[model samples]
Target chain A: MQQRTILSTIEGHAAADPARVFCRFQTGAGTEAIGYADLLRRAEGFAGAFAAAGIGRQDTVIVILQHRPELLYGFFGAMRLGAVPAFMPFPSPKQDHALFWSSHRKLLALTGIRFILTYRAIAAGIDEHFTGLDVRVLYVEDILEGLAAGTVPPAPPAPAIAPEDVAFLQHSSGTTGLKKGVMLSHAAVLRQIDRYAGVLGFGPGDVVVSWLPLYHDMGLISCLMMTAVTGAELVCMDAFEWVRRPTMLLDAIEQHRGTFAYLPNFAFLHIARAARPGQRWDLGSLRALVNCSEPCKPQSFDAFLAAFGDCGIGRGTLQVCYAMAENVFAVSQTTPGQPVASLDLDVEALESEARIVPAAPGRDSRQVLSCGRPLPGAEVRILDGAGGDAAPDLAGQIAIRTDCLFTGYNHLPELTAEKLVDGWYRTGDLGFLHAGELYVLGRQDDLMIVYGRNYYAHNIEEVVTACDGIAPGRVVAFAVESRQMGTREAVVLLEPDGTREAAELRRAVKARVFDVLGLTLQHVEVVPRNSLVKSTAGKISRDQNRRRYMEERAGNG
Target chain B: MADEESFREVAQAIGETLMVDPATITRATTADDVNGWDSVTHSMLVMEIERRLGIQLPMDKVFDLADVGELVDLVAAARSAG
Candidate 1:
C-alpha cells in the first residue's frame, strides 16, 4: 500500500468527488452543505488567510470554536500550510476561572500558539483572559469574509510535510489534573485513519454523524480526520445539541442516511433514556456506532438496542473500541456482525488477587466486554509491576507500540520520557489480554485501594449509578487516605439530581458499593451533577476532586 | 383560563422540578433566580414539561423560556393545540 499524507489524500478525494457533499452544519439560519469542491476552496482560502496572518510551517495555531464547519476549515487550513493546529477546549464558566485560565496559559505556553482562530461568540466570552498575551486572535467569520472578498493573499507553495512531521496536538482528558498534549505526526494520523476506515468498512459513500466535541481525540481524529481523508460526508453538531435533544441526532442520521457515527458510553445511555414513545426515525443506514472515549458498558449497548430497535439499529451495530490520543485514536475495533464478547469474571477475585477468573453464564459476575484485538501494525502488552509481560489472566498495565503512536507530548521532554518507556507508550490503563482480546479495567491511577484490595473506580461508579435515584454515569469514586485506618479508604461521590434525601442516598450508595465491590465505602458525598470536575477530554478529575474534598474538610476543621 | 392561571401551573411545576419556591418564579425571573437552573437543569425542565404536556418544543423556544410566564404560555399553547 502506498501511504499518502493526509492533505494528499484529501486532495485526491476532492478531485474524485468535487460535487459530493463533504461537510454539513446546522444553525438557526438553516442547514448548509459544503461539497468537496467548496470544501477545498474554503480550506485553500483559510490557508491563504492564515499565511496572510504570518502563520507558516511549524507554527502553532489554536482553534477554539464549537462544532461548526468553520472549525474544520481552520484546522485543515493550518495543516495545509504545514502549521500545527491544536484544538483547545472551549472555556466554561462553571470551571474555576483562575484554574482554567492558568491551564489555558500553560497549554498556550506548551504549544507556543502564536495565533488563535475562534468564533466571535467564544472569542468574546474569553477575550478578557487573552489580554496582553502575545498571541493574535482572528474571528473565523471575519476570516471567511476576507476570503470571500478575495483580499487574502495567496498561500505560499505547499511545504513538503514529512510523515514524521508533527501534524496536530490533542490534550489528554487531564483526569489526574495534569494535562499532557499528545503530538500526532501526519503518518501516525493517516495510519490510524486507514485502520479505522477499514475496520468500520467506511468509504467515500459513507456519511458520519458526530456530536462529540471537536476538541476531544475521538471527535477530532476519528470523526473529522476520517471523513476528511475518505471524503465521507460529515454532519457535525455541538455536544450541547446532542445532550439536549439526543433524538435530533437520530433525526439527522436518518435525514442524511448517515452510515457511521461515534459516541461515548454516556451518550448511548442518554439516548436510551430519552428515546420517547411515538418518536421514530429510520436509522437503518447506520452501519457502525463506534463507542470509545469512555468504558463501553454492556448495559448501555443493550438499552440503546432495545430503545431504538425499530430504527434498524441492532446488537451487531454497536462496536466496542478502545484508543487514546497517544495512539492517534483507534487501537482496536470490533468486527461487524461479530457477537459482542463480554467476559464474566468474579469481581472479588479479580480485585483481590489480580486474576481474571471466568464465571459461568447466568452467574452473578462482573462482565467486562472485550474492546477487541489490536488493529494491524499495533502491538499491545500487559506488563506487571516489575515491567515484565504478565500472563494472559493476570491484570497489568497496558503498553503499546504502534505505527500510529504519537510523537510524544508537545515540548515536554520530561513528561514524554516518563510516558514513553523503552519502545512502547505506557497507556496508564490497567487491563489484561485474554485469548488475544483486550479488556480495559480502568485507568491505573483511578484504581481505588480499599482494605488492601484493588477496585476500579469506573466499576464502582457503574454500580453506584445503577442504584435508584442516582444519576447514571455522573458518579466519581476514588480512594482517600483515612486517618484512622492509615490506609486508603473508598470514597464515592454521587452526583445525584437533588431529588433524593442525602442521608438515605448516602446509605444506599454505601450499601450498593459494598454489595457490588465487596468493599465498604468510608464516605459518600452526594454532590450536585456537573459539580464533580472533569477534564476537557471528558475524564473525571479524581485528584482535583480529592483536593477539593480535603480543602472542604480543612475549612470545617 | 387566562395566562396567569397557566403561569401559576407552569411556575409550580418548575418550582417542584427545580426544588425552588414557586413565588420566586415570575415574569422577570431568570434561571439565575433558582438555585440550580444550569444548562443541564434547564434541559431537565424542558424534558419534564414536554413529557407532562406531550408537546415537542423547538430548541430555541426551550432555551428562550427564561421566565415562568413564557414557559406557561408555551406549555399552554402546546396543550391547547393538542
Candidate 2:
C-alpha cells in the first residue's frame, strides 16, 4: 500500500462509502447535501473546466469565490490535477475595490499565479481595476453551466502525486500585501489529521459543525480536511451569517446531532449574548466545543455555559486547543471529557519578573488558561531571553517541533530561515509549562487577535501613518484587554502634523484603516507631536506608548 | 409610537453601537453606508436595540435584515407580538 495524500484519501472514502453525506452546506435559504460521490464528481467537473482553460499540474490557482459550494469544488479540483490551490478572501462590500484588487499584484507576480477562480462580480471588478498582470479570471457560474451543458471537455486522468508534494497554501492573516503563504505538504496534512483526530476521537458518525471561513487554517484543515480525509460529516454555514445570527449553530447541532465544533473565544461570547434568555435547545449531542484560533479565555467559556448549561453544556464539554498554520493545525488539544486547567498568577510578578508565580493573598491575579498537553508527535519548549530553554513555570517565548510542520513560507526564504531554526519553529507566543500542560500568556510579538482573527499591530501602524495629517513614524498601534467584550480591542495613538482638524483626522484614520485592512479600530487618539514615547533604539516604542495610554486612561477615569 | 419614531430609535441604536452620526442614518441606510458596520457590529446593534427597547427580536429575521427600515419594522412587530 502506498502512502495516501488528501486527494487519494478522499477518493478512497468516496469509493468505499458513496452514499455517505460529506457536507451539509447551509446557505441563507436552506441546506444543500453533497455526498462523497457527488462531491468527487462535482470536483472532477471543476477539474475538467480548469483543464480546458490551461490550468495544469503545479500551476497556482487562486480561488476567490464567496462561501459557496464552488469554493470547495475549486480548491479540491486544483488538487486533483496536482495544481496548487490557495484560498483568498473575497473583497468585502465595505472595502475599496481598487485597493483590494491592486494589493494582490505583488503576491500574484511573485507566485506567478495566472488563473483566478472567482464569481462574476469579482471577475468584472478584477477586469476593470486590476491591471499589469495577464491573469485569467474563470467564473464559477460559467464553468458550472458549461459543464452542465456538456460544452466543456471531460477531465483528464488524475495526475500522479507524491505524498511529499505541496497540497495547498494557507495565507497568514494580515493586510493583503503582508500576507505570507504557508505551504503545507500532503503528507504533513494527513499526519496532522491522524494525530489530532486521534486525540479528539473523531471519525465516521461524528458531525463537525463550523461557521469558520475556509481561508484560515482552523477552518480549512480542522473542519474541512479532517472530515474529508476521515469520512466524517461536516455541517457548515457562512461565517458572516453565523456572526449576525449565531443561534443557527445551535439549531444545526440539534438537527444534525453534531458532536464537535471549533470556535474562537469571541464566538463563545457572541453566541451566548445572541441566545434568548430561558430558551433551550437539545445541544446534548455536542461532546466538545473546542476553543481555538484565539486565546482560550476561561471567562468566555463561563459565559457560554451560563447561557447554555441547561442545553447540556458544562465545564468538561469546553476544551481548548493551541493551534497555528505553521504546525498545519493543532499543536495541543485538551481531552474532550476533561475540564480545562487554569492558574491564577500574581499579575505584578508575572508581568515584571517574567515568572509564573501563584497569586498571593490580596494580590492582583490573572487567570491563565491551560492549552492542555502537546499532541503525540509535537514538542514544546520555552526559550529564555538568551535563547536557551527556560525553566518550568517561567514565561518566555514558545518554540515547537512537530511532525506536521509546514514546508516553508512560500516565496520568502529569509523569513523561513529566521523562524525555522534547527527543526524548532520559534512561535512568537509567550507561555510556560506546568504539570505537562502549556499555559499561554499572550504574545511576545505585536500580533493581536480580535474576534478570532490575527492582525499585526505594525500593519495597523503602517496604515495609520500613511493617512494625511499624521506625523510619519509617530504612530503606534496595540491591543488592550476588553474583558466585557471577551476579546482584545485594537487601539491606535498617533501624533498629528497640524494639517487637519483632530476630529477630521481621527475620522479619516478610522476610515482609512477600515478600507485598507477591514478592521475597525476600537479607539483612535490624535495627540500633539512628541507625545509618543521612544525606545532606546530611537524608534517609537509600541509597548511604552501602550503603557502610557493605559495609564492616562486610568488617570482620567 | 409611529413608524417614523421607531425609525429614529433604530438609527439612534445603530449610531450608538457603531459610533456614527445618528442624524446621517436614514430609513434606507444599510451597512454599506456606515464604516465599521460589518457583521460584528451588526450583532452588537441587534443586542443594543433589544436592550434599549426591552424586546427580543427574532434571531432568524434579524440576520436577514436589509436596512434600518427593516430593523425598525422588526422591532415594531416584535413589540406588538410580545
Candidate 3:
C-alpha cells in the first residue's frame, strides 16, 4: 500500500478495500458518501469526458466549484487525465462581479489556464468574464449528464503521470494585490502527505471532519489529500454553511463520531464566542482538534477552553501548527494528543528588540503559543538581518529548506527567483526559535490574516478608491487589532476634502470594501489628504497609518 | 418608488440598522451613492428590514434590488401578496 504519487496512493486504498468510505458530506435531503472504488470510477468517468473534449496532459484547468461533492470529482477527474488543476474559491453570493472578473482576469492570463471547470450556478456570471481571452469553459453538471447518456465520451486509459510533474497550482495571497501561483509537483505533494502525517501521528483509524474551503492549502492538502493518502475517513462539510453556523462543526463531529478536525485560530475563538447558552456538544469523541492557517492567539485558546469546558472537551486536545502553501502544506505542526505549548516572554524585548526572554513578575509579559519542531528532512532557520542563522532568542525572518518545496511560481520566473534561493524558500513570516520549538511572530510584512484568510492592505485600498466622491488612490487600509473582535479587522482611512460628511464617508468606505472583500470593517476614519504619511516612494505607508491609528485610538480611550 | 407610508417606515428602519441619517435613505439611495451598502452589510440590511417588516426576503430578489427604493417595493409587494 506504500506509494509516492497521490494517484497511486488513493488507487492502493481502493485496490485493498474498494468499499471503504473515504469522503462523506451533507446533501440537501441527507448525508451522501463515496467509497474508494466509487470515487475512482467516478473520477475516471469525469476524466473520460475531459479526454473527449481535448483536456488532458500539458493543460492547466481552472476549477472554481463550491464545497459540494462535485468539487472532489472535478479535482480528481482532472488529475485522472494527468491534467494540472488550479483551484480558485467559488465567487461569494455577495461578491462584486466587476471586481471579481478583473481580479481573476490577471490570474487567468498569467497562468495561461485556458479551461475553466465550474458548475451551472457560477458558470453563468463567470462565463461572461472569460470571453475574449480564448478560453474554454466546461460545466460539471452538463458533463455528468453527457456521461450518463453515453454521448459525450469514451473513457481513455489513465496517462503515465510522472512524479516530478506539476500536480496542482497553489496561489499565495501576498501582502499586496498580487497573488502568486505556487507550482507543486506530485513528488512534493506525496512527500508532504508522508512527512506531515507521520509527525501529526495520523493513522487509518482516525477520521477527519473539515469545512475549510477546498481552494485553500489547509483544506485541500492537510484535510483532504493527507486524509485520503493516510486512508483515514473524512466527513466533509460546506465551508459557507459552516461559517454561517460554526457550531455545526461540533454538531457534525458528535453525529459522525469524528475523532479529528483542523481549523484556524479564528474559528476556535468564533465558535466559543458564538456558542449560545444551554447548547451542548459531546466533544469528548475528538482526539485531536488542530489549529492552523493563522497565528495562534493565547486569548483565543483561553476563550475556547473556557467555553468548551462545559462540553466535555478537555485540555491536551487542542494543537497549533505553522504552515504555508509554498512548502506544499505543513512545515511544522505540534505533536498530536498534546495540549498547546504556552510560553511567557518579556513583551518589551519581543516588541522592541525581537528577542525572547523569560518574563519576570511585575514586568510586562505576553503569552504566545508554540507551533512545534520542523518535520523530518525539513530545515527551519530564523535568518537575521545579515542573512545568517539567528540566535535562539532573536526573532527574524522564518526560512525553510524542505524536500517538498514548490517547483516555482507558474510563469513569473523573476518572482520565483526572488522567493527561492539555494533550495530555500524565504517565508515572509517572522518568528524566533526557542527550546527547539518554533514560536512564530506575526508576518514581517503588512499582510494581515482575518478569519484565517489573507487580505492585503493595498487590495482593500484599491476597492476603497473605487467608491464615488472619495479621492481615488488616496486611500489607506490596514489591519487593526480589536480586543472586542479577538482578531485583526480591516480599517479603511479615506482622505476626503471635507465636502462629504465624515460619518457618511466612513460608512460608504466600509460598505464598499466589504462588498469587494467580504471582510467586516472595524473602523473607517476620514482625514485630510495632507495628514497621510507617504513612503519615500510617494505611496501611503500601511505601517505608518496603522501605527498612527492605534496611537490615536489609545489617546481617545 | 414605494408608497409614501412604506417608504418612510422602511427608510427609518434601514437608517437605524445601518446607523445612518434616517432622512437620507430615500428612493434614490443606491449602493454606489451610499457608503455602508457594501456586500457584508447587504445581507444584514436585508435581514434587519425583514425582521422589522415581519416579511421574509429571498436573497434572489436581492440580486435585482439596486437601491432602497427597490428594497421597499419588494417588501411592499411581499406583504401585500402574502
Candidate 4:
C-alpha cells in the first residue's frame, strides 16, 4: 500500500470511484446523498474560500457551524489546504449567546485560532465578544454564494504534508466548561482507523448511521474518519434533532440498511423510552450497536434488549468499546457477532477495597460488562496509587501505550507532560483487567460523565460560588448514578451566605449553572455553613460529601 | 380542550416530572423558575404532556418554549390539528 495522508486517501478514493456515495445527510428538510467526487469538490471550494482569505498550512481554523452540509465541507476544506481544523458546537437555543461566545475566548486564545468558519448569524454573535482578538470570521453564505456551479475559485497550490504532522485537534468539551485539545497526527489517525475497522470487519459496503456530534471523538474518528478512510457510506442526522426525536436513528437504520452505530449508554435508554409501545422497526440489517464513551452499564444494555429484542435485536447485537480522544478512538472493542462477557462481582469488595471479587450466590453483586480486548497495537496497564503496576483484577488507574497515541495536548506542554508519562498515557479512569478484557469502573478524578460529556466538579462549584447567596468555597458538586436514566446526574450542595428561601436558593443555583455552563444540576440543597465535609488537607472532599449525601437520602427514604 | 383545562394539564405534567408543586406552576413559569427543568427534563415533560393530552406535538416547535403558557398553547394547537 502506498503511504497517504488523510486528504490524499480521501482524494484517491474519490478519483478511483467518483460516483460512489460517501454520505447521506438527513435534516428536517430531507436526505441529500453526496458522492465522493462531489464531496471533495465542495471541500475544495471551501479551501479556495479559505485561501482567498490568506489562510494556509500554518493557521488553525475553528469550525462553529451547526450539523449541516457546510459543516462537513468547511472542515474538510480547511484540511484540503493542509491547515489544522477543529470542530466546535454552535450555541444551543437554550443557551445565552453572549455567554456561549465569551466561553470560547480562552479556547481561541489558547489554540491561536486565526480563522473561524461559521454562519452569518453566528458570525454576528461572535463579533460582539471577539472584537480586538486578532481573529477573522468567515461566513458560509458569503463563501459559498459567490461560487456558482463549475466556477469555484482555484485554490492555491497544496502544501506537502507529512504523515507525522498534526492533522487536527479534537476538544473534549462542547460549548462550555473545560476545554482540552487532544492533537492527533495524520499517521496516528489513519493507523487507528485501520486497526479499529479491522476489528469490526468494516468495509466499503458497511453503512454507519449516527446522530453523534462531530466535535466528539466517537463521531469524528469512528463515524466520520472511518467512512472517509474506508470509502464506506455514512447516514448522519443532526444530534440536537435526534435528541428530541430519538426514534429517527432507528428509522434511518431501517431505511438505509445500516450496519453499525456507536452510542453512549444513555442513548440506548433515551431511544427506548421515546419509543411508543408496540412500535417497532426491522432492525435485522444492523450488525452491531456499540455502547461507548461513558461507562458501559449492563442495565442499560438490558433495557435496550428488553425494548427491541422482538424487533431483531439479538444477544450479540449490543457491544462495548472503551475509548478516548487521546488514543484517537477505540482502545478496546468487543468482537462483532459475539455476546459481550459479563461478571457478577461482590459490590462491597469492589467499591470499598478496590478489589475485584466474584460474588457468592444470592449476595449483593454488580454486573459489569466487558469492553473486550485491546486493538492490535494497544496495551493496557493497571497502575496503583504508588505509580506501579497493580495486580490483575484489582482496580487502578488505567494507563495505555498505543501506536496511535495522540501527539500531545495542542499547546499545553506542561499538561502534556503531566498526563503522558514516558511512553504511556495515564488515563484518569479507574478500571481492571479481568479474563483478558477491560472492565471500566468510574472516573478517578473529580470529573463526571453526564450523557457522555465530561464536566469537572470544580467547574460546577465555581459557577455555584459565583451565584448570589452562596458562600465562596462552600459549594461541592458531584454525580449520582441514575439507573432509570442510564447516566450520571450532577448534584450540587452549597452553604448559603445568609438566610434565603431554600426554594429560591435552589432555583438560583440551577439557573446560574445552566446559564454559565449549559448544564442542569439535578439536585441543589442549601445546608448549614459548616455542614460540608473536608479532607485531611482542609479542602472540600467531593467523595466524602457525595457519600454523606447518599446516606442522608437513604435515611430520608 | 379549553385553554384553562390545557394549562392545568400541562402544569400537572411539568410538576410531576420536576417534583414541584403543581399549584405553584403558573403561566409565567419558565425553566429558570423551577429547579430540575433543564433540557433533558424538558423532553421528558413534553412526552408526559403528550401522553396526558393524547396529541403528538411537532418536535421542532417543542423546543425553545418561553414559558408554561407557550407550552400550553402548543398542546392546545396540537389537539386541534390532530
C-alpha lDDT values of all predictions? 0.75, 0.87, 0.78, 0.87
Arranged by DockQ, best first:
4, 2, 1, 3
- The residue-level lDDT of candidate 3 at A219 comes to 88
Q: Write the per-residue lDDT of candidate 3 for residues A57-135, one digit (tens) a residue.
A: 9588878887777777778888888898878777677666556655677667766778878776555576577667867
Tell me what fraction of the real C-alpha contacts between chains A and B each candidate also makes: 0.07, 0.23, 0.00, 0.43
**Per-candidate DockQ vs. reference:** 0.15, 0.27, 0.10, 0.51
List candidate 1 segments past 4 Å from native.
A1-3, A92-103, A120-133, A175-178, A360-364, A447-557, B1-45, B64-82
The DockQ score of candidate 2 comes to 0.27
Docking class of 3: incorrect
* Candidate 2 residue pairs in clash (backbone atoms < 3 Å): none
Candidate 3 Cα errors over 4 Å, as ranges: A1-3, A125-128, A174-177, A466-468, A497-520, A535-538, B1-82
Worst 10 residues of 3 chain A by lDDT: A170-179
Candidate 1 per-residue C-alpha lDDT over A1-557 given as tens digits, one digit per residue, 9 for 90 to 100: 43478888888877876778878887546689987777777788899999988999988888877656787788888998999988866654333333344446545655566688876654444556656667777888888788778788888888988888999888654421245668899888888888878877888889899877777777787788888888888888777776688777888899999888887775776676677787788999988887776666787787788889778878888888888889988878887767678888987778787888986666558878889989988899999998999977789999999888888887789888988887699988889887888888866777654422346777677768888887767787777654322235567777777678876787676655544343456567778777888877887787778888878967975
Question: What value does the lDDT take at residue A557 in candidate 1?
Answer: 52
* Candidate 1 lDDT (Cα, 0 to 1): 0.75
- Per-prediction TM-score of chain B? 0.78, 0.92, 0.83, 0.94
- Model 2 C-alpha lDDT versus the unseen true structure: 0.87
Which residue pairs in candidate 4 collide? none
lDDT by residue (tens digit), candidate 2, A88-153: 888776567777777777777776678889878755567654467778889998998998899988
TM-score head-to-head 1 vs 3, winner:
3
lDDT of model 2 at position A210: 97
